[model samples]
Target: MTKAHHIIIVGGGAAGLELATKLGNKLGKKKLAEITLIDSSRTHIWKPLLHEVAAGTLDSSEDQLEYLAQAQWNNFRYRLGRVIGLDRESKELLLEPTLNDEGEEIIPERRFSYDTLVFAVGSLSNDFGIPGVKDHCLFLDSTEQAERFQKNLLNRMLKAHSQSKPIEQGQLHVAIVGAGATGVELAAQLHHVTRLVSAYGLDSIDPAEDIKLHVIEAGPHILPALPQRLSDAAMRELHRLGVTVHLNQRVVEINAAGIVAASGVIIPAAIKVWAAGIKAPEFLKDIAGLETNRINQLVVKRNLQSTRDESIFAIGDCAACPMDDQGNNVPPRAQAAHQQAMTLSRTLVRRLKGEPPLDYTYRDFGSLVAMGHYTTVGNLMGGLAGSMMVSGYIARFVYLTLYKMHQAALYGWPRAILISLLHFLRKGIDPQVKLH
Candidate 1:
């Protein structure tokens, strides 16, 4: 009897989870292939929502998807383990043993053979060798880190409010090290949430007087990745909200008190957030002798298959696919990852049927940045055969549609609509920002 072909997918982020859902529904139930998804965490949360999670605007308990539950619904196997090594010749993936919080072995190290493999481990914040950053700053790369910051923020506020004497100096100061989408949105959301938190019985603290937010960026202006007009609009809105904007300031160190810039200026703060850059996990550098870029992203061909091995594929932030059109590589963003996931899904389906897979070409759909419910700005492309700028409520509507698009891709139309309605109903009943 012929062995059943197996397809293994490592990582369960936006791309991996969507791909697994699609492929499993297509092949797993039909008994054509065994679909397996391995991830370190048992639940999945959209990475873009991490900033809001950190700021307490979104409750992770309701938003996160349980991997095992999803696997059961989507007809796929979920394995809880980290991929430690790969044996190309044997076509087996070596998984490291998993340990629980109490140091008990939850899953032992084992090998899972696959006819095809897909890697979508995603990326994390890049400190760029800045001194004291790893020790003093918080990065919203995962749900755990976001929860830690939120808890710390709540504790700091309570301690300051309960103090007998006057509010101490630098009590609610927050320094954000980047002015990109994450940093800008986080700063704006924090401003709103801080006010809400104070109004919700933390009477000793004043949002306008006690809280301080500073956004430091090395570029000439904030939101450098977006169009100048949109960036200007966001900057103006942030300034109107009383957020100090420090442009062209490169952080050299993240001291306990604050951040030190290259210009010899020190900014003091009670909490610091590092949101500047991102790089793939360190382990990918030597994985299977693959050629990786400076940030340790695997180099892949136009077909989205790794150059070192055709049977292995990568997508999302972990793969570096060059673009000859602009003489630059694809930018690491949620849209890029979602697009790549769709492309790979189609290609792999064709390959399963013994047909040639097509080359993956990235379409440049413009970018959008949201500053909470206050406002939104973006550039729209492929509109009426041209591109145009958009802002305000209309842009906010479009911004929300992007998330819906992601949901539609994974859950289909009916389920996506139901889930969205449920989310809205829950939001109306619960507090907008998490207080605890």
Candidate 2:
């Protein structure tokens, strides 16, 4: 009998989970390959929705998919463990022992041999070693972080509302230290949701009067990666929503009270959110002498295979793949990850059939910025014959379709349609923002 081919995937994120589902349905069902997905968490949530989760605009419990349930339904095996190291020579992945909240070992440290290994561990916030940042500032990199911010926000609002005296200084001040997509969206969403929260009988504290939002960026402008016109439109909308935009102001320190700019000026804030940049996990940098970029993304070839070992493949935010057009590198975005995942699915299938995997190319699908109910602005590339700028409700619709597209990729047409309908139906019954 032929030995069963084993494929080990580390990280059940957007890219990893999708790839696993596709492969499991295609290969695992036929017994052509054994597919296993390893992740630290038992649930999976798209990382892009983290901003919405952070602002309490989206309840995570309703949307989060259980990894175990998904794996069982999709014909894949799920292992709960953190990958600590890789043994390229031995073709084994070293999984660290998993512990429960009570400090008891849940899963023992073990090694999993694999014919092919794919790393899709994703990226995390890069604090850049700023003073007091790790302890004082919140990051929206994980579900826990976003939920923590949401809980803190609700508690702050409730405390202020219950106060017998007038609102004190710095009552609900939020300082977001980045004008990137995540920070900007969070700022706008907070403005819209906080007002909605106030309407639900948090009457003593007025959302507009008591809550203040400060968006700080070291760059000269917000949405620096987007076109100037779209960025300008976003700036205008943010200003209309009473968000203070601070440009060219680098945050040198994050204290318990607020953030201190490099210029020595201190901005008083009750909460601070850091969303400036991202870097692959530090562990990947020295992982078995693999070639990595400055941000610790594994250097992969055009075929998405690691430079050190072709058996090892990397994708999503963890891989540094070259851009064909500019000779630069692919940008880490949800779309890029989705595209790479699709490409790798086909490539892996071909490889299983004793065929060479094809090189992966990233296609630019343009970008969109959603600013809650205020507006959405974006440029449409690969849409018309040329690029076109879109704004307002139309842009908002397009922006939402992006998330739907992700759902379609993962769950197919029927499930995606049902999920979308369920979300819409829940909107009528639930408050727009989670007040508690």
Which is the leading candidate under lDDT?
2
For model 1, what is the alpha-carbon lDDT of residue 384? Answer: 73
Clashes of each: 0, 0
Worst 10 residues of 1 by lDDT: 322-331
59-103 in candidate 1: lDDT tens per residue?
888778899988898888999998888888889899989999999
Q: TM-score, each model?
A: 0.97, 0.97
lDDT string, candidate 2, 178-214, tens digits: 9999989999999988888888898888777789999
Candidates' C-alpha lDDT: 0.88, 0.90
